[model samples]
Target: MANKRTPAASENDRLYGRALAVIRMRQGIPQQRAAERLGVTTQAWQNYEAGLRKSIFTVDGLSRLATALDVDPGLIEQVKGLLKEGVSEAWMSDGAQPLPTSGSEGKVVFFSRRAEPEVPPAEELAPVYGAVFAGKPGAIAFTPDRPDDWKPVHPNQRGYRDPFYLQVHGDSLSPRFEPGELAPAVRGVWPTRGQVCIIETHDGAMLLKYYERRDAQSVWVRELQPEPREFGVHLADIRAVHAVVGGAVS
Candidate 1:
């Protein structure tokens, strides 16, 4: 007969199982698909989700599971509440140290320190504004009303002169700049044809669109998805145009 796990080990397994199940549901990954990606039987995956089996994941196994869910392994540890404050290393090693578990008065550290590569610090941080609609032209009010919201950008980000972040809104640029995504905008950078840009109108209305071209009299812009349509705005009605350097899903 197989030896039974200790009570503490079983409790840890249950916690990990519950955390994994929650993450899978939140990520919208079907159990069958996740099992296939993890190279495990569907029933085995179900057992983990159901807390019927103890979780004893190796480093590779944990990484593979994280990849299948499209999330960082640290996120999994966080969800399970296994990560303790000031505990930088999340994995257990031969020389692992004990950290206090939640609800436990004494320290119960489970992770060990490992010689890992150092990560460089982030470049500069840019203010993240509320959603900016691409379909409607709105005011280009540049102010630090809410300085708390911001995102860090790498120093080498292309066209990153005086860059700021804006959350995208509307489906005018769907798939390219989905609603709720964050986009980096660089001021003082002139955009070329086929490049995405944020345009400010004379009336203070701002909009995001693809820069088709611009003549002495007017500027031509278009939407890329949901339906392609072009607009011609007279040069006299324009104020300033900022090019979109990059974007990421929020």
Candidate 2:
């Protein structure tokens, strides 16, 4: 027997089709032209736009579609709202079962169908630390003193947790970053390759650069400025590492 489509999946298909139609119309591109740009047959594209067919665009396909439509690929995810709405409606219509909040084993299981609890506003401010360099060591040490001189940033504004800010100085990371910019770093979050991060050396020095890779003995980094420069430091010399959430020009 064939499986049936769930309400959430059906809603997703409908929303995707509608959004695709709207984007195509807004771009003033005819169905045939849009289909050709997407490298699909006219009938297949029409069926997709009419919600008769499901969308199966891969990562590269989505990028191509976004390029042809002149829109960001992330915009396609907006259809998720339709799935959420469908789930809510299904829970209401199908009489959702509520499991016990606490089980005999002293455990708790929360159902997704239930309304989400209210989240309090994040009002706490994160402190900005002293400047971290992108070059060789300076005479100054990495100090957390003088909280009065630091900038206080709201964590909710950037979706960060236990965030601390740092000032950027030197030209090694120029073009992408400039001196006097406030870089927000989230504690305890490990950064992947190509992400900007704050690196603290055991000798009490701090640096900010793009994280390249790390091995058992050393951490490699890159600086994109006048040109790309790569370097590595022994793990023994490193104190701590934090991912740079974002930054603002001061």
Candidate 3:
């Protein structure tokens, strides 16, 4: 079944690759940067866009790409048609578009951002070493800027650091994150009740859990919520607030 899935996926991959290539080239962006936007390995993204690997794309994935390029779905298809095999548009969505569909005139691709974004946004990330490892503002050691160790995962991707990204640990925020997912949490200081928060546990664990504030100086962290599970919410201390990761997608 896995093999079967791969073949068809490869087809989508090919078309998907070509479309990405078209979009990147036209927009004058680098392949590595685009790879990060797609959450793919840089080399893998490059291979696909180069049409060296199969073109595979999912409706959800295509939709997301369309959102990033700020274009309509048809615009990608139309642009692809203008290119040759192995030739792809970095801004196009379906890979290299096949030429004028058998006696059909090509319509121009008008770029637009009307297409809704697939996810809230690409999450923001900060260096694990940045600032004080405090979970709340009061506990923080005054630091004016991000740590020197900070670097965007996709250094080549434009505005890569704008969205928040966090690393998570433990099962406190289970269902939403696991130990090995290398959670890419967004950045925010104020998290609504029951939202997962990434913070350095006073006990020395950098973990994520549902956070609640009792007052300015008091807060509690909980586990197994938003639904009943094996565990339940518990009291926690708010040390320093770094960012908010999930919920409220547009």
Top lDDT: which candidate number?
A: 1
Once model 3 is optimally superposed onto the true structure by TM-score, how far is the C-alpha of residue 75 displaced, in angstroms? 41
C-alpha lDDT of candidate 1 relative to the true structure: 0.61
Off by over 4 Å in 1: 1-120, 138-148, 154-159
lDDT of each: 0.61, 0.59, 0.43
Q: RMSD of each candidate?
A: 17.7, 13.4, 18.6
lDDT of candidate model 2 versus the reference: 0.59
Report how far off residue 60 is in candidate 2 (Å). 37
Distance from true location, Cα of 7 in model 3, Å:
74
Worst 10 residues of 1 by lDDT: 91-100
Candidate No. with top TM-score: 2
Model 3 sits at a Cα RMSD from the real structure of: 18.6
Per-model TM-score versus the true fold: 0.47, 0.48, 0.31
Report the poorest 10 consecutive residues by lDDT, candidate 3. Answer: 95-104
Q: State the lDDT of candidate 2 residue by residue for 51-110, as single tens digits.
A: 666545556655566555544454444323423333232232221222112234534433
User: Which candidate would rank higher by lDDT, 2 or 3?
Assistant: 2
Model 2 misplaced regions, further than 4 Å: 1-123, 148-160
**Which whole-number lDDT from 0 to 100 does residue 116 have in model 3?**
37
